[model samples]
Target: MKQWLVFPRQKVGLVCVGKPVRCSGQESCSNWRAISRTQILLHSFLLFTFLLSPIAAGAVDITQQLHRSLNSSVGRQSRDEADSLLSIGEQQYASGYADKTIASCLRALELYHSIDDLKAEGLTYNLLAKAYVQLGSLKEVEDSLRRGLAIARDTQDFQAQIFVLNNIGTFFLQQGESAAASKTVEDALAIAHGVKNIEGEGLSLSNLGLVAARLGDYNKAIKLYENALIFRRQTGDAIAEANTLNNLGDAYLASGNYQDTIATYGTAMQIAKTNRDRTNELRAIDGLVKAHSAVGRYERTFDLLEQPLTLAKELQNLREELKSFESYAQLYKQQGNYLTARNFYERAIILARTLEDSKQEVQLLDQLTKMLQLK
Candidate 1:
């Protein structure tokens, strides 16, 4: 028998294949919210494409049976089956099985619709949106989120409403509609505050900070991030707190506050390390390197680059590996070490070609060509 990992649906305060779990405080909600938000944001970076292919399946048989049960009846039994399917779908999503997650969620949605379980249907739509995000199906993502939003409103599920709104804002942010993103997140913030959902409120605030940062309002971004950090800390959400610290560091860096940037990123790095979150750890390290470099701390910058470079290789994340090489090359170029810079640039170009990232390849080639001309 294949072991299936189960996770609670924090937003809905529902547990699947486990005892009841309650979010009594912001801190209590932190772990689930932090994990979910990280997964969502990671996928958001792959804006126009999927980063992973469907992996081998282990829960296929059980999910298939759930689908059959959900489709075969229309009564209390069917409703129970729908709930099971939704639970399984959530599990699949948490397990990183995007394709299976989509299939399971769709079946659950159908069952919920048949039973007029609008709230459950709405949640299913939210799950579908996430799966669609992983698949890079922009249209599907939009449609599912919209549908989920509508259901949340119709059912007056304030928590679900806030979650959907935040996701929509994030999607808009990724699409480069900063103005729309800001407005959407502001709406989410207002609703979250009204509902006294500290977790939702904090997340919205963080997203709004991102929008502000994108708009070059670094001061405003920092202030918002600070407020979000307070809420994240209040809830004992180490991951969320770390992410906010990273964002705060980014704002400080943008404003040329290298010392503050380094301090903030260091805190984030420590938290990421404690959480064993490699992605956030890499982000913190990247931010630290840039800040150190800006302050002429070349030794620290070079030292900081080593871990992310190794971590990128371990993760087999070509994009991050390419980033490491490019950063190394840029730093060498800044130091007038053309030969070293050229070597790193060549490595970056090779990774870009392997990843079939034509745009990045072109950019690297152009940079290398310019470096050669200078030589």
Candidate 2:
């Protein structure tokens, strides 16, 4: 369960299970666009390589054989080839090709198992689970994660176990089974503490906080996030620290402590900026905008959203771009600037359709239709 911030140029998004499903606004759109652009860039680069290469087939084969021998283990190129395939799959997944990702992960897992690499096996299961999760396969989530857990336990790898536990807990959390999620993650935290793994401790703490937050235990959530923040700071894990801050800010917001929310997000913003984490910075910007808007601080909202919007557009990230459009709609809606809201809403709708996100397309259409009806 990655606490994702919405921002332009952010590289990672941890969408929590069962969180309100917002339309993948401008930010998400920009992310998709960037992915598309990267693919095009890579294809062009490969095309150039193909054009430049000599057609000495025998010589190329001999060179390839030598290179393969240098890279292969025991004359078995299976592992290396599998790894390359896995890399390709990951690149495809990142570029928004889910089916290709699943295929690639499966091939990699098969190779890893053939080579008897427990670590790679576990990781492949985790990745496969992620792809299944996106495809809305709950059974796959349980099955894949359980398989990963078994591997972790077999190896007695506490770190891997921690990841499995957190992943499982997140799955349960998404399923709305709060108690089970809590129990599972709490046990993982206990193990992390036993092993004195500070990074795992921080992550476990965040999971616990998320569970508590879902349970309406804001105080407990705050405590967990605060503890996680300490561990994150100690490890100099700015990304984790920023995520913890965002979670803490969410808790504060839920409790109607707007000032504290502002403070928490402000800290996250500073940390993200310092780390040059574009994703977290974008999320921080979103938090900042929401916080300011809640307090009727239009000037602050305007100032904060400007850079996020610019970055989203520059990166061609569809998600961020859509978010920017939605944020603008929200902002104007709040201010009773209906005409401006309508304009932004229209732009968001177009972007959503362009990205082929049916969910977002529907949501935008519904909102726009309602606005039109009001007019």
Candidate 3:
């Protein structure tokens, strides 16, 4: 039988080199004296190997095969390799390359599973979930999130659990299950509080706000979002803070507080611009356009849509382009310019056809017919 020696400071048990010796306290622990040089070297080598194990995994990479072979030969790849892959995946995701993002994350997930690294596995699942969401694969997103939650639970990783739970809540919200979303995010909030993780708590609060907003509880949602914004700011999460502000703007808009909506969205837009977060910036611009139009600031609405339309083209985002065209059509219609509205509606229909969105194309065609009749 192998004897074990416990190191109090390290909180690890080392195999005894010879006969086991008991110590009453730290002062009497003399097992170090019995450890041979060769045994110490062996232990050191093992410790080094354990320390060098991969910290995290993420999406695919161009040199993925090379990295995998290197990892196998060296027993582990460097943290830089994992970070690089993660960066690539994020870029791909932002660029709307859902398939590439999925492929990268899947490869990273495989490596993580091979190493039995639960933390990495959980994170990779989150990445995969986002990619699936972009691809409109709701079932795959659900599966990915469930797997991530399981890994977090099994590993007793409280932070990871909170993240997975928050994402699950958001998924529920997207599915129009507001009550379920609220319950799930509440669970996440509890776990975040238990772990004293500020970031997790903030995210949970924001997600809960989303649930409330979906349920038409705009005041409650505003309060929750304001609280979340504070936490996000404290944690230095500018992106999260901007998102919360945008949510708050939406809540205010729902409550018929047009001025507040405009103000909140303006702040969010500034933050998004400073952070170079184009997605959030676009969201803020959309919010501003609505708020401005509500207040009869038609010219301002058109001015706001200008950059958003330009950005949609630059990003090759057909969906946003369609939205921009529709907004323009609505603006012209509201100004009583039937001809201009008809022209914009035609442009929107063209874009919808390019996207192969039959339903949207039909809707736009109907609107165009109506506008032409008005003309």
Best by TM-score: 2
- 2 against 3, candidate with superior TM-score: 2
What is the Å distance of residue 312 in model 1 from its true position? Answer: 1.7
The per-candidate count of clashes, in order, stands at: 2, 26, 3
> Per-residue lDDT of 153-223 in model 1, one digit per residue for the tens?
65566777676777766666665556666777788789989879887777778878878887899999999
lDDT of 2 by residue, 76-100 (tens): 6776766676666545543434467
lDDT for model 1: 0.67
Which pairs clash in model 3? 59-104, 59-105, 60-104
TM-score of 3: 0.72
lDDT of each: 0.67, 0.65, 0.64
Q: State the displacement of the C-alpha of residue 358, model 3, in Å, after optimal TM-score superposition.
A: 5.4
Report how far residue 77 has shifted in candidate 3, in Å: 6.7
What's the distance in Å from true for residue 356, model 1? 2.8
RMSD after Cα superposition, model 3:
16.8
Candidate 2: C-alpha lDDT: 0.65
What TM-score does candidate 2 get on C-alpha atoms?
Answer: 0.75
**Local accuracy of candidate 3 as per-residue lDDT tens digits, 265-375:** 999999988987676788889889989998899888889999889987887766677778988998889889988888889898898776555656877888878777876
| TM-score-based ranking | 2, 3, 1
Off by over 4 Å in 3: 1-88, 314-318, 342-375
Better by TM-score, candidate 3 or 1: 3
What TM-score would you give candidate 1 relative to the actual structure? 0.66
